[model samples]
Target: MEIRLRVESAVRDEAEELTSALHDWLREDRDVGRHARIGRLADSGGAPSGAMSADWFGWVQLIAGSGFSTAGLVYAHNAFRASLPRRQQTVSVVIEHNGTRIVLEDASPESAARIAEILSGSGDDEEAPGGSS
Candidate 1:
């Protein structure tokens, strides 16, 4: 299954920076990296800021293969948040699966669990381009 993720911050620069940071951070995860990847270079359309990019901005393509754990994904997110400084910790991370969205801010375990649950489900919602029904 795959989900689209984005980082949002009060400042555009922070959002862009955090988006790249989280992407790199996810790639370092043994479990997640094995099954997930960010936008493909061919899908990329360069712009002033990656966060503000017109194509594939801040999107994560997660493939929950055998041995893939939703908890691991959530844990990685929580850990990433915990790794940030207090001020930047408030930056928001959004995960979207089958129309369900889980926003991570304080990296609460409850939120992590909720995201895990979402990711663990049968994620067959193949959104159309522009997200039209």
Candidate 2:
């Protein structure tokens, strides 16, 4: 499984700071460890993006191995949210698993919690006594 959170920052420096914070958070994760790969997003001009007044400079990409549980993902996301200032950050989450892709835009705590429940198969599974899957 691969998870990537792409957030837009106001400026290039903020983007760099966000990247650093994300790296620190991931490293702190017991599953992600300290072997995650980080990189920046580029534009069609082949130059690093997110440099314009409202361009795409606030972009950071992270690559990590699988072994991360749903609960762990939620924890990581929460930690990431707490690590940054309450700036107007627009975030998108992408998860690739077994060739299938899942994308979530403007992911919030509620959405993360729901995703955790779904991934962990902890959602409402109780049947009406006679119901079936």
Candidate 3:
């Protein structure tokens, strides 16, 4: 199975930087790197601050294979967040499935875990995206 994630940040420069960070992480993680890869280069159209772009200002494509685990991704995200100072950063994630896209932002812990389980294709609960436990 494959999972595609679209990541975005409120600040254009931050968006670009985060996209690169995510891509590098996925590529360098031993376990995840064995089964997953960055599907494509992050799409951050070069322009001035207010330039129009695709659905999101920045994007990340997370392609997970059989060996990849949702927990790892979550852990990586948490680690990344921990390294940053406490501040209100608007980072959004969108998952695409069967042509439908689900946007996730500021989700509760339960909802975030549930979404991860769903995306990892390891959940049997059949809960909708962003659903809390």
Candidate 4:
């Protein structure tokens, strides 16, 4: 699955750096490293498309492959959040996966995992009694 993660910051200039930081952080994960990459959105002159901000630099794209699990992506994201200082605060995060958009503003581990399960379609089986599919 392809996941687009954008770090929203009040400082427009900081957005790009923050996104790159996330990409680097994700690479530290053995499983998520190779699959994670920084993605760029092409600019159309001075005005950007209605779909996104013109000033928006880009975001980190995490494509989970056979070697990595969706859970790893969640782990990397949370870890990155924990690494941030107060000065480098991120307003929020918009994650788009398979047309399912999830906006997170300081979500807890449980909440994050539950979201991952939901997005990966793993919650259904786990929710079933005796783990039946």
Between 3 and 4, whose lDDT is larger?
4
lDDT of 4 by residue, 104-129 (tens): 66646664765576567555423221
- The ten-residue window of minimal lDDT in model 4 covers 124-133
Off by over 4 Å in 4: 35-56, 87-90, 121-133
Model 1 C-alpha lDDT versus the unseen true structure: 0.64
Instruction: Estimate TM-scores for all models.
Output: 0.73, 0.50, 0.63, 0.69
Best by TM-score: 1
| Candidate 2, 56-130: lDDT as tens digits | 433344565455567666667666766555653344333333332334343465657555544544534332111
lDDT of 1 at 78: 82
Least well predicted 10-residue stretch by lDDT in candidate 1:
124-133
Q: After superposition on all CA atoms, how large is the RMSD of candidate 3?
A: 4.9
Over 43-119, each residue of candidate 3 has an lDDT whose tens digit, in order, gives 54443255365444355576777778777766665555454445633365555544445554544575466556667
Of candidate 3, the 10-residue stretch with the lowest lDDT total is: 124-133
**Clash numbers, per candidate:** 0, 3, 0, 0
lDDT of 1 at 118: 61
